[model samples]
Each structure stands twice: as C-alpha cells, then as structure tokens.
Target chain A: MLSVHRNHPWQAFDKLMRNSMNLGRDLDRMFLNPLTRQRDSFAGWPQFNLWTNDDEIIVTAEVPGLEADQIDVDINNNQLTVSATVEAPELAEGESYQRRERFSGSFERTLRLPFAVDQEKSEARYVDGVLEIRLSKPERDKPRKLSVKAG
Target chain B: MNNSTDLKTTNPPSHELQKQESPTPEGAEPTRETRLYRPHVDILDSADKVTLRVNLPGVNEERTDLTLEKNILTIRGHIDPPHYEGFELVYGEYGVGDFERSFQLTNEIDREGIQASVRNGILTVELPKVKQASKQKITVAAG
Candidate 1:
C-alpha cells in the first residue's frame, strides 16, 4: 500500500499517543491480569501479515533475534495459534542500558482461519527474522468448478 | 522460488524524500523532506564493551551496512516488499520500507575494536570500551 507522507507534527503526536495507550494496556496485562482474569486483548509484540487464496492461507510474522526452535505454531478446528518467548539477552557485568525499547517476554496470538485447513499439509519456515507459514485448504473446503451441459 | 541460500533484503520504496529539508528565505522551499522511520535500538553500556541491538526486520546480512566515521555510527539496510503470486492481503498492520539510523559514539568506545553482525534480522554491534573508559580505582597513601 502506498501512503502519502505528510509533514504534520500532530500526526506523529497522534501516533505517539496511540502507542502510549497500547503501552498502558501492556502494563496492565503485565501487572494486573492474572491467569484467571483473562482479558481478550489482541495486542501483541512483533507485527504480522495474513493472506489467503483459493488453495491456502499464509501467515508471516516479523520476529527478529529469534530462532525457529523458539516459536510454536498450532492449528485446530479453523483456529491458529502462535506462541513464543523472546528472552532478554544476558547483560555482562556492569552492563546497563541507556534505552531498551525492544520488548522481551512471552506472547500468544490466536487467529481464526476463514476456512478449514489440512493439518498434515502445513509448513513453516524461519529466515532473517521472518516466519512464514503456509496452511493448505482441506479438500472439502476447496472451491470446485462445475461442468454444465446444455441441450 | 523460495531459495534458502539467496540473501533477501526488504524492498526499497521509490518514495524516499530526495532532498533534506532546509529553510528558504522566500518561502519557496518544499514543506517536507523525506520521511525517515527510526528503527528500535538497544544500547547497552558495559564495563568492557558497549553493545547495540537494532531491529531491522526483512533486512538480510548482505543488504545491511554499518559504518563508523568520526565518532558517529550509522546503520543502513534495504528490505524487499513481499509478494505472493496468488494471495490477496486480508489483514496487515506493519509498514514496509528501508531502514536507516545513526548514533553519535562517545569517547569511551574504542573505534578500532568495533564489530558488527547481522542475524535473523537483528544487527548486533559490539564496541569495546577503551582502557580509560573503565572505572579507575584510586589508591590513597597515608602521608
């Protein structure tokens, strides 16, 4: 998508405000939300993309500094879930950060697929901090082109 | 073709501002310059070294560039826009573009000893601290 760049300070401020609001919710989740107090919050770290075609659904997530082993993708009954933990890098002795903006912790993202998928035909690959997963549509869910005979 | 060996850099957009913004006496100058997004970075100051963790998603090792000149460090990289032949985008929130950011280095860093590596879209730069940068212990002599 193409976006027009505008030199408006208020726009940036608006984005900042929105980010702070998200941070407030994150803080709440970090401090207040226990396991029982389940808030249906969709906010999570590392942005992603989801697309679909007639044959399959694909998901791509940008998660830098993570290995493939650290991520877990699961699908069941048209629901897809991705869970991962990004451990903070160990600091050497006397090490301190002037600024630490990158987030580190566990996150779980659950998505509802548009159609049922064949679990056995799915695959995932991780490269250069991008994780791409392909889930093939089930045979029953595939759209069929019917043949018509005219007399 | 999804080749694992081929290095991938995120797509570079043609929309980057061509000229730096400057003041014009007659108010004839363009109102805006190129928009540059600041990449998130972590600067760790340690006794032995200072490390930087920069997030440059979609940028590969081959497309990344790190330079240190006159106590200033700069990082630049390009990312190719993703294209799937048959798929239509259903949902998206992240924007794609090239990444560029620079940092002024302090005197504590050893200019010759800096090292950088890019892995899994994270650029790690280690700047070893000079001997004098470390905290010095002073000895007191009783007179």
Candidate 2:
C-alpha cells in the first residue's frame, strides 16, 4: 500500500509533464500551420466587455482616438451596434514620417444581449474616447420580492 | 487593386503636412507649418469593472506618464522617430505621432485602487469600483 501511494504521486507528476509537452508541441504546430498563419495576418479586431447588473446591462468598447460625435450607437431587434472612424491627424509639412502604427479608418462592432433590453430606457455616454452604453432590462426580467404563505 | 494603388500614390493630408514641415535646405525659405497629434482610445465595461486599453506603439513604459486630475485621466508619452541618417526612405506608409490621450473617470471608478500596466505596446488600465459604489445590500428591522 505504501508503494502504491508513493507511485500515485509519481504517476500524476508524469502525466502532468506529458500534458505540458503536448501543449508546447501543439503551440508550435499552430504557429507553423498555414491557415493559422494566414488568419493572423489580418489586423486585430477591436475588443469589448459587457457587464449585467440587476437592472441594466453595460457595454464598454475600447476605441481610442475617435471623437464622440464620430461614434454611432444603434439598437434594434435586441442587437446593439457601435461604429466609428479614426481620422489621421494633420501632419506638419516636410516632416518625413518614420513609423506609423496607429490604426485609422472605420470600425464596426455588433453585440447581442442574452436578455431583451428596454430600448426606451437605454442611455449612451462617451467620454475621453470611451463609449459606454447602459441598457435597462424589461420590467418582467428584473428581480422582485415574492410573498410566501405557510401551508 | 485600383484603390490600393491610389492610396499608395497619394499622400494623406497628415502625411503631406509632415513633409511640408521638414527643415528647408540652406538658402530656401522656411515654410509655414501646423501639426496635430491625436491618439484614439476606447473603453469597454468588463464583468467587475471598466477596462481601458490604449494603443501606444513605440512608447516605453518608463517614458509614459499617467495622471488623474479633476476626474480626467491623462496619458502622455514621447516616441523617438525612426532614425536613418543616410538611407532615403522609399515607399513608406507608417507615421509615429506623439502620444497623448485622456479619459474622464466616473464615480464608479475606485480612485484609490485603479491599476495600470503596459505590455507589447499596449497600455491597460483597470478601473475598479469603490466599495461603496459596489455595495448592493441594505437591512431593516421591524419596529
């Protein structure tokens, strides 16, 4: 029994090491795979996060360098869409540019809410380049106190 | 294909301004110039807090500075332009502008515990809620 107990830990360790090696090999294969490489060539799409509370759902999208007026927010049929364009800044004459990494031009993103939202009560705000939208959920979906009766 | 070539051939207004701003050679009159630099930023809400990621390439963490004044969070950094003294730039597309961006913080942010970090040219700022703002419970007793 003592031998079996000792061997159990060793077996677990061996399995963990094998899994680690497999993961490393898989990563290498992914990097070398042609389809994966081609997909990576495209510029990364913008990223966003959504949070839901008892009464509302809030969405925040990372879209730097765009003006609040340039951004458009629309909600229809339970779908929300945010779109904007970042125009290049005016440059000084004769100043040759060495590198330009900032992404300019148009971007659009659409999100679907798990629960239906009350469009009439929704609010949107943009400050310091971050666009935030708060969508109130329907009254029926909100939590309520239910009375209980003793049998 | 046609549009791509057209873009390649014509300089954007910003690029044209940059070229006109270059120092004139001896005996040539200096040209009047105006320059503008704007950094784009977007903020998205996460499960527990708001996550702000700023795209600031060529900006080192050491050179970047962040400050919150009057609810506005300002980020500033200087980037060194590419240097090649002798080689002529040919068919260039990228331009590096000085980085400056600011965001107004709301009451939801936990001012005391806001966190920031930079990795791979991206700056991520995590704005958490204060304890009071995140609280959801209240209790009452029958008289």
Candidate achieving the largest lDDT: 1
Interface RMSD of each: 12.5, 20.0
DockQ, computed on Cα atoms, for candidate 1:
0.31
RMSD of candidate 1 to true structure, Å: 14.1
Residue B55 CA displacement from its true place in model 1, Å:
1.3
lDDT of each: 0.71, 0.57
Best model per DockQ: 1
lDDT for A118 in candidate 2 is 84
TM-score of decoy 2: 0.39
Docking class of predicted structure 1: acceptable
Backbone clashes under 3 angstroms, per model: 7, 29
